[model samples]
Target: MQAILQSSDTELDIVRALRENCERPFEDAHAMPPAVYTSEAFLALERRDVFRTEWLCVGRASALANCGDYLSAQIDDQPVFVLRDASGALRAFSNVCLHRMSVLLEGRGNVRRIVCPYHAWNYTLDGSLAAAPLMDRQPGFCKEQYKLPAVRCETWQGWIYVTLNEHAPAVESHLSELSKLIEPYGMGDYVETFHEEHVWDTNWKILAENFMESYHLPMLHRATVGPHSRLEEMECPPGSPAFNYHWITKEASLPIGNAHPTNTRLEGHWRRTTALLAIYPTHLVTLTPGYFWYLILQPQGVGRVHIRFGGGLAPEFVDDPQAAGYMATLKTLLDEVNAEDRRGVEAVFRGVHAPLAKPGHLSPLERPNYDFARYLAGRLGAT
Candidate 1:
């Protein structure tokens, strides 16, 4: 096993400084300036130095379960496509036609050839230039020179990751600690059950930081998550690898006693061993007995984020299509909880924009969010 990279004394000092500066009283949460939420300049910098260089989860491997299956998506404004070719090898591409710079596929489907709509230029599922409308008419047209541009794609624990840079290192090299962190739960065996897209009117970082801490659950999601999950019971395992942390919370268990008076069938469903794990940048994997939810947050712009929530169920449940309905019901319940969070975050965004705001202190209970912010600041070359 490779040795985990230890944080140097300088890194520890930085952490201490961040903890001291960011952690303040509850009233200070609103003190954080609006720039963190609304600065276009900061967003552009993050896109170039942070998102561009990081390994980002784009889709799930199961999305391409059969031969010739493919999905097209945009990662941080860069167009990319994921496909399982005829030979069953998963591949990713720039999703742009080599001929005239047009997108080859708009959505997901099974295709023997990816034909560009702007022209009849077609490429094989493997991204080879298979056909062109009238290449012979163009004297200098060369099939080899016009093949689709390929991107670096890899799969880990059933999730698909793509990087825009051709020469970027392998995904494993960057996700040094992720494998061990997820191994305990047998993540590879879980099946996806629910998936949805939500638009958040805040920076992707804000959403990420919000998730790293359970401090807000009591206030923001009092009805759903608060009664069951408590900050005191939330466990942040020590000696966790940098940029990634492992946590196990018992509060995720369903409510009991008086809390159960108005409990519905859904409460019994959610009570089943709910586990949450987040990989850096924008992937959050949460598991429960009834379903597995994988969230991928894509930054659309400075003030907008596209959130994809994919749910996977146990294989036994998936064998019967009817079971998917149960999963859908769970998703609906979650949608309500998420809607509450969305409104709260939007309110925070508005408050941060006020001229009275400043960088706030971090609470000891909010160590996870503070750590995450420090990680982001380090990656974006911020102090």
Candidate 2:
């Protein structure tokens, strides 16, 4: 009894600390408490209130152009899939076999139908149970009554989002203001050329906070992007109810980071500007004039994270002769930057577990992190 009480008290302390941090003025803001990242009870609260109810992004809508192209993902513990049905409409459904309750799909692919490998109980492209072999002997068995339960799915800009909660607000309206802000970039028209998933040894929020701020770019990523970053030029504005963003304008070292030579959509400094958008819960995007990349994060217990990572070229650069070269260069730089972030975030996670570790003061460049702390605290009912 005493041990559990101690744990609960510790969690409450962290929550209060977070609320206090969010209330502080920007000049006195602080990073999140270490306990916020290490508590299993807090993760359960987030899974119920945040992950289950939020509009979680699965991937780019362009990835499922064909009638039967499907992508499978696990939201916290619930397995789900997003696909384009025969009617050429986007759809999402619970990816579980009704018979033995096995997961139906594994990864991204084109399929004429979804078949359960366990018992050969198959479903059509629309998720209607097409057949149930060896079930003729079962009494009162009706296949029509066993269609896969549909999940709420929507598209905002060009990205696909699925939510377990049917009553969650529509993704488009929730992010409409953000859409208008970046409309000139034509994000909806970008083409995804590469995608890969990896698990990292850090709390999900750690990686998210890393993406939210560029304060560590000078020292942590000095070998790659650090030299080009100017701390004084970055703009960290107040975030909206659903998202936070920062801007960095630079004479990009990588040709693809700046506007391509043929590009005319962006004039003047817009050509060299980069937008780092942190969509609530766990979507982060690095949008430049020539290309874009994003991370869709989910917690793997309290100690690690599952990252859905991908990127691609802007419409202007997609079909050009140098498209392949640009793709290669972007992938290489992204890989290098990712390596740096992994090291930095993993170290922070390690440090958080130390006995004397605590939340530190935030730099002005870390305004996005401050906003993110408020978002997390608010969702967890701490604010």
lDDT of 2 by residue, 170-215 (tens): 9999899999889888889898988899999999999999999988
Score every model by TM-score: 0.81, 0.96
- Candidate 1 per-residue lDDT, tens place, 145-264, comes to 766778888988778888876666787766657676544444555576445677889878677767666678888888776766656665654223344453443433322211122223
Structure candidate 2, residue pairs in collision:
none
Best model per TM-score: 2
Top candidate by lDDT: 2
TM-score of 2: 0.96
> What ranges in model 1 sit over 4 Å off?
1-33, 238-243, 246-273, 316-326
Q: What is the C-alpha lDDT of each candidate?
A: 0.66, 0.89
Error of 2 at 213 (Å): 0.5
Clashes of 2: 0
